[model samples]
Target: GAGVSQTPSNKVTEKGKYVELRCDPISGHTALYWYRQSLGQGPEFLIYFQGTGAADDSGLPNDRFFAVRPEGSVSTLKIQRTERGDSAVYLCASSPEAGGPLFEQYFGPGTRLTVT
Candidate 1:
């Protein structure tokens, strides 16, 4: 079976533009997560979804960022009014079940977004 995948491996946009990053998780994985990784920094948690609803979105930096998993499989991360500070590699991960200390997550290659 295919693993988690992210589209548009790289993206470049002007500041104040809007961009969407997509992710497809493994079939039947009930938990999905989004993260942002900046230069030399660890991935920062953005949001977590269980099934078709968001379980935790506290990691989202601000209102400009949002994500949805309408059917409990594929998800999209939407960024509005992009800024230079938003440039980073956006990563997606999925686990067999909900995230916990014992569950392992599979990760995608990530979509690199650059706002110039």
Candidate 2:
């Protein structure tokens, strides 16, 4: 895909199961982001990565959520000991280096997670 892509568009799991959601960003985009959206809400930022390191992770709810972008291309969002409130759509976005209009991100279709 020429734009960002998210795998496993929908996920259903028990309340305490662990899950990993993946995102593939546009080639050559050096900045990537993760966001989560619950029912009837806008996407909320989760993390931002520049190159292979996390530049900002304050959006993560707690230690139960983590993300990594080892090669500056693909990123994985990991959730541990999930609860029913964890159910939401996980979104991935990317942009070029943060300068001028390139700082704006392009978002991918989200991955829907459902915890039962």
Candidate 3:
């Protein structure tokens, strides 16, 4: 079975532009997560989706950030307005079930976004 995979491994864009980062979760995994990692820090939770709806999106930094998991297997993270501050490594993870002490999340190679 294929693991979680993120597209465009690296992205470079100008400030104020829009960008979409994509993620494909492992087959049969019902839960997916999006995270952002800045320099010198750990991955910061951005959003979590269970099934076709977002279960937790409290971690989204601002109105400019949005994500959707329309069919529950693929997710897209959309940034309305890119900023230098947004330059970071965007990570995607998936698990067999929603978050809990029992299930473990499998992470994908992050998509590095650089706003120039």
9-110 per-residue lDDT for model 2 (tens digits): 999999889999999998999899999999999999999998999999999999999999988889999999999999999999999876657478999999
RMSD of each: 0.9, 1.2, 0.9
lDDT, candidate 1, residue 19? 98
- Model 2 residue pairs with clashes: none
User: Which candidate number maximizes lDDT?
Assistant: 1
Estimate the lDDT of model 2: 0.93
Is 1 or 3 the stronger prediction by lDDT? 1
Question: For model 3, what is the error of residue 103's alpha carbon versus the real structure, in angstroms, after optimal superposition?
Answer: 0.8
lDDT of 1: 0.96
lDDT, candidate 1, 1-116, per-residue tens: 89999998999999999999999999999999999999999999999999999999999999999999999999999999999999999999999886476889999999999999
Error of 1 at 107 (Å): 0.3
lDDT per prediction? 0.96, 0.93, 0.94
Let me know the TM-score candidate 3 reaches against the reference structure: 0.97
